[model samples]
Target: MKKILKYTLASLIAISLANCTSDFEDINTDPNGISNESLTQMNNHIGGSFTPMFLNVFNVTPAWNFQLQQNLLGDVYSGYMTPPTPFAGNVNNMTYSLVDGWNGFPWSDAYGSVMPFALDIKNAVALGGDASGEKFVHLANIIRVTAMHRVSDIYGPIRYTKFDDFETTGEYDSQSEAYQAFFTELGTAIDELKAFEDDAQFAPFDMSSLGGDIAMWRKFANSLRLRLAMRVVKVDPALASAEGEKSLSSDAGFLEATDMYINTGFAHPLTVISGSWGDVRMGAEMESILEGFDDGRKEVYFNPAEDPALAGAYKGIRMGIEIEAKGQYGAHSSIGSVVDSETMQWMSAAEVYFLRAEAALRGWSNAGTAQEHYENGVRASFGQHGVSGVDAYLADNVSTPNDFVDALNATNDIAYPSDVTIAYNTSGTNEEQLEQIITQKWIAMFPDGQEAWSEFRRTGYPRIFPVVVNNSGGTIDTDVQIRRINFVENEVNTNGDNVAIAVGYLNGPDNGGTRLWWDIDGSNF
Candidate 1:
């Protein structure tokens, strides 16, 4: 047996010497110049890098506030990934009312690019196998859950069961069922990643640092689970606590909210025109909220409006109110555009803290104090956007912490308190606490678009008034509002049956105003 193994090794080495390069020449193909190692390995690495890059593009942070949606300032932010401001301007799709048609395509992107590549990395590692397999699955599942959570949030009960088979027909799956998949996947991922003992498993996968790459990735997975538990607090409170408890239960465990983020220190290049935030501006509604509170982040986030230093003149649109016809509001943005390439963000520490804060307030017992987790989220949000002296802000009036409403109005209040603390009154009902949870969830969303939209749809807390001028060729019913987007044009022509089945579940003729399954909460009364 020993002799056989030695000869087998010799055979491979001899082959390498005899004809390392294939003789076949199809002028287009390179035999000698491109090594087999390069062909195989580079393809996988390039594919891996490409997935994160493309994801950085679509994670737009949708909000009813100026910090989020203006063409210029908002675009430059890590909070949201927005489209190029069009010539006449706006997301070019005619179906732009409910969402930019692009944000609506996670199904194709996740299954096709994001999720599959992540799985590919794992497969490659397993076949011949690299130690990186663990991180590959961990990170992939983080992103996969991120995209899937949005799919379930946006469209309601999306088609999860027909995942690989959506090729035949895009069958619509139930929201509860889809969430169960997220539950199983997240739980398994956290367990698998936490169990991985090697530090080198994610060296190449590190977007941040080298030493603890896999550890950070493990935290990201756990943090993502924390976030999912919060998102469905409305749909399933029992499950929410169960998941959170599971994390605390893991002894050999992961990073908690206070230390759970991977800060993506993306720097700006020489050119703004091609940069990430260059074309996007802080949306008026978002800007107004920050400015109204004298929220320090306003300046860090937005350049003073080109013509006016007065906050009211900047991207100061009202939230959730119907805009008058297009003529009523200025389509032109007052702040400068977003420098696109300048920012990159990832699942953050503050986000996890905020999730835990909400969970704690609802009495989901856990590792950290609810109040501490809440303040950590606020502090992280402030620091990320360059807001200074945040520690001082929280310390100014330490006895009484500012609740979510206080923070929301901090920039807008006439009598804005100079000294406010991050405190919660347990006397506030669970209903009231839930509102506070979501409202800050709105503010902490400076750089994430999909989560903001998802939170808003589920909680409807930071409500936006209707669009004054929408030409989406669909009705904006006062009762139902946005239901779902009309199926993408190509899909209707190609996967008509699945689209038809989804429409049937919708009850409301299947357009943007249709209410999805989980979004069917609360009495509009």
Candidate 2:
């Protein structure tokens, strides 16, 4: 990684631009006499790249609990969608946050960090450098995609090609274009990695330091390809389906074990319990999910809601009522339980397996029997997570659904510690097996991204609940949940015309309640 040169260049720019603008100088200069060593410069840059990956961990906590967590719990986000909004609002609450319809406040750790360093890494590869060069390009590409998705998914447009240029203001590409670019970027990187084809090894880069090793980098790249493909399911099925299939068919590896995942080992302050984000309780939906499936992972996902103050007066928030009145409606529901302790979930291989299962089920190229992929996904999840014995799981009612309808319904069912997977129960129909597969997949990714929500939306397999008790939103959801977030406030100001076009086409009349391109139909697209 050639870093000192970039800083020197920036400093030179700062010296020249000081007369024109103090702000430019501020961005380009430090004045602090920090060590000017090349290794130090590289470390500074790498440390900065950590945000895309770290912030992603935060984005999903709210989403996992908000989008996937509560939906599985009982179909409510903190209830920003409902009449009397929950204290923690939906899509609106995330600072400068939007799902897919608007603009966002843009920051550029990835631009300054991941992008330049990656360019260096790519250049090194081109020069026939060692495994470290290949590793850097592969991991940097994965990191780049991660950051791009977060920005593009939220704001609907971003600067991809000219992103890192300090001199240029940068052009905003449409979300469709950005998604396509990501597919190209990651796919090309994958090919380059294979082209490098190095057997030599070196000291592994810290997941905290960079991303990981060459093999892990390949797995991470493939896994990300799966995620990005899934993202466009509503917008471009043909493309999304093809991307999904390629990962499944290709020997590109995925994170299947806990150890194999991009484990950050992030310090406690960043954990769900104590991080700046606050201890994310196991959202009520997640709790319900665990209870419904009779899944044992609840123990791993959360601790019992502790009102441990022996002198308690209900000071602690009730488990599932974070967003008060709004949760009464469908799609306006419970979230993951907030635990007393802090926790951090980087990534998991089980996630990759489940993602693969989805690709296979959709009948992608080189995809295997859905049944086999689904089962392997289940076993791999169980095996990686440390749950044991299929015997106890088979006996459970909710977790082991007897038929397809029963299994789909089981997703909304509160999972219990005793609930286990018993796919061996051949007595059940094939669809029933899919229910078990998706339901478990939902459970596996509890603390990570919104796969469960996407799976539920796409498959509609694990039947969940409607907001039957109270009509908070008052909209009356007939079939299933709403898709996509309303774009953030800034879009109207910064990119008004383009934002309007997307909202008009994508959101329809009721913008917030609208669906994205992939979520064509709720009954499992």
Candidate 3:
């Protein structure tokens, strides 16, 4: 990582134009575009490429794009939220009918924004010098894994390892293969960064809350390794243990007291979409689960519904109902003030504790007792939300997720499927313990529906409610629900050959019905 002085996009062009004064009129090319001098500017180096990649992963502007990229798909499917408006006549993603146009954002946004910038950083560094560029390349690798894993989780297969060259630029790797690549990349990054632990090259470009500390970045990489390792525990137990233990054994600590959030200089997308625009509302499951647990954080997570008929209680809407218009559910609980802050969450410390809890239940080395981790996870979440009384809440042990009742439409309501309680059940079976850990994790990771949705597909815990309507045109089963989004239509149109090969990598049809590689649709025990 080279220390490059930050320059504005305008200044870079100004300098290039100032230098080319003699030949400026002869060459009628825009100097602001990727001109030789513009590309060679100090700001265009390894550090420069990161801002674009970081910002794009959780895109800030064009709120509608963020809505499609995450809110509508993962957020709704994970049982964390439900859209108030009846999109496409109530036959859209909420109803299991895949929307080609809406489903394309996550794919297009990643490739169009995050992926290309990551590749540019790698290329820009490699073309300069190997020794000097190695650190930058490793940093780029960490960012790549962070962004691409979500993309792979969405579509089952993605162009990752083979994205370097023109000949194989359009190639795709199956989810399993991509996970392996991610582990390998993390391993390399952790190892290399340890040697350069005192390096200050990363300071100039640091936008993370960690402030470009190499040691902290090393810890982040290790923590990420643990996360990915646990993601595959069900599908490949041995590999999961090996990778997970490596993380536990490392001196680079996991994210414990602090979380990973970037200061993006904008309001959280959820605030704009839910609070300002009134497009999203609380999910019925949220209302049921929080009320059942008597969770105090609910006050911070959601606002009291405006529907006077409900007497100012927190209410949520169910997915896939006959919504005539947005106004029908506009008065329902919109996202609360917690999301109005000006930062985007990449990961949470509470989530790490829950992950450790699951790893402990699996009898992994260095994970500590399952009960301890589970309680800590709850405490971390409570602290994160500035709520007190965690000890009393954790001790009750009597509360269970309440049966969901949709006041708007009782026909769509469902009873609580499981009786799992909050207190740590030390004598319970492995399956019971796993469910407790996952369910707590699901709650702590509110608003981050991508990871929650992936966990739901893999573990089948916490019992997410199924959609009331099945509108997949005989392609998706309502019980299993939508597993993963189909390959983006843009890829199919421009890269048909690769898309065909990618579809073959899927376990089932290349639609929302298909599960990804790590999402084994069976018992973990």
Worst lDDT 10-window in candidate 1: 400-409
Consecutive 10-residue window with the lowest summed lDDT within model 2: 310-319
Candidate 1 residue-wise lDDT, 1-525, digit = tens:
223333543454345323422222221154335445644454355345434533433422232122222222223211222222332344233213444434334554444445444444444333333343455555565666666666566556565555433242256666677777887887787677665646553454454432345555656667777777766766677887788777655543444433332323433321232233334444544543454444676554445533333344434432222332333333323333222343444455666777777767766666566667767777887765667867665544233212222112233222222222234434666655555555555666655555666666666655433333354565645433443445555445655666676667664665666666656468311
- Pick by TM-score: which candidate is best? 3
Q: Over all chains combined, what TM-score does candidate 1 have?
A: 0.69
Local accuracy of candidate 3 as per-residue lDDT tens digits, 1-525 = 001111222244345345423343322354333345533353345566788777877777778888989999888888888989888888899988889999888887887667666766665544443354578778878888888898888888998887665557688898899999999999989988888788877787877877778888888888899999988988899999999999989888888888888788877889889978899999988888888888898898899999998798888887877788888888999898778787888888999999888888888999998899999999999999999999998998799988988767778788979888899999999899999899889999988888889889889977888777888887888888788899888778777888899999998888888778998877887
Runs off by more than 4 Å, candidate 2: 1-135, 154-171, 195-205, 208-211, 230-237, 258-280, 306-346, 394-433, 461-480, 495-498, 501-510
- In angstroms, how far off is 323's CA in candidate 3? 1.6
Candidate 3 residue spans exceeding 4 A from truth: 1-44
lDDT of 2 by residue, 451-517 (tens): 4545565555445433323222433243344444455454455546545655554535324345544
Give lDDT: candidate 2, residue 502.
Answer: 53
On TM-score, the stronger of 2 and 3 is: 3
Model 2 residue 346 CA deviation (Å) reads 4.3
